[model samples]
Target: MSSSSSSSFIIRIFIICGTIFNLSHQIKTIDALQPMKSSSLFIVFGRPGSGKTTVANKAFESLSLDNNKNNKHQQCIELDLDVCISQEMKDNFGRGIYPSLKERNVFASGACDYVEKQLDEKLLKCQQQKQQQKDFNLSAIISFSFVNTDLRDIFRERFPKAEWILIDTTEEECTKRINEREGHFYKGDTPDKKKKEEEVDTTTNEEKDMSDWEFNPVTFPHIILDGNDPIEDNANNVVKEILGKNEEI
Candidate 1:
């Protein structure tokens, strides 16, 4: 072959290689730009008396409203594991009975174990559903009692893709809120009120005597927010972070 023809052939091969490389880069960029298709699973974790439930509810409401307003194809579900377990305990025991925080601690620990098992089952169900429908997504916001580092590590290992948000509230504030809400347990019954009044003495002491639960973040990447912050604002900030709207907020 002529030297000029050989040079031209080499040039043509180089152009083809460049085009393939450019196309691959563009594909990667496109994937990055695309909205994440995987359903986002979030765990709202904190100690008892923190605003985990409140924040979870706020996020649930916001997501529900957004879905209705925009007719978005995504679905968000909030699963309050504590509430579910508490109700189950209540039903098993009897009606018109309340568990003390200490009793609740025992209940929550066991309930969390059960909830985790249920989550595994649900994941399997979701996998089967996904095989039939490509657009089907299952998202969950869960609130749980996070006591030790080991539990945190387990959660991190189990749900590596999910986001964890910790509600950080001062002990004093949590106690105050708990005290205010305790009134609802008695309602307008006089005997119930008297019983509750007597219980307050012990409850106050219990609250004051409670130890601080420390959060060590050696295992999971978590975003911590002030529990005292307005629920609406906190929810919005969380949503923004989850959607990658604003960083370092």
Candidate 2:
């Protein structure tokens, strides 16, 4: 065979071998992770504008179960509570919901309810299907600020093997980010809407018990990730850290 043809043949062989290796790895991982071994609740905790979403998006993309026949829906699904709440608000009300920075407690209370519901539903399904180890594949990555210990414990109970990540940035930087950020629910496109959203009492606490989680001083033990760096770089580094940790599994 010609050298070029030989090279092409070798490449095809490599691809086929890689596929087999990937399948083997998937099965091995599934067996090892029986009863949700590969499972972990990656907590992206930070005040607004600390690049929580960016790192989260990157982590979701980077982490995944190896390709297997029963793993079509396999992925690191992000339960971004902020987006979920905005969506929830839109569903209940006729328009979008935008809570001010100070009204974070209201947002958190609503989001916690929604997050718990999601966990209950997903975990129920997982428990029901735990016997099917061959098809076992599900992991939830929640991106939210666990400003208090109670909220953190709630998720921890549902997902015992939780991973904590706190994006460290000053409030001054977060304020600057709040002003510069666009397409945010609270950070409206038009000046008028922005002013209105920024104004207090625009979002009613229908239930007064929705006190803020920030009052809880206890923060979960977390890996401090630098949020000041370029988003992509920061994301890639966070992926490296997570993947590095999972290399043993």
- Among the numbered candidates, top lDDT falls to 1
**For each candidate, what TM-score against the reference?**
0.53, 0.53
lDDT of 2 at 61: 69
**Which runs in model 1 stand beyond 4 Å of their true positions?**
1-38, 84-136, 183-219, 245-249
Clash pairs (backbone) in predicted model 2: none
Q: Report clash pairs, candidate 1.
A: none
Instruction: Give the per-residue lDDT of model 1 (tens digit) for 1-249.
Output: 999999999999999999999999999865544434355667887755677888888888887787558633445667776554554544422332344446555655665566555555555554544421334344567776565555555556556677788888776776566556653222222454346556736445555333323444435567888888898888886666554521211
Candidate 2 lDDT over 50-156, as tens digits, reads 77887788767666533233344343457887665556554322232333443554655666667556655664455565533444445566787565555666666
Candidate 1 root-mean-square deviation in Å: 12.3
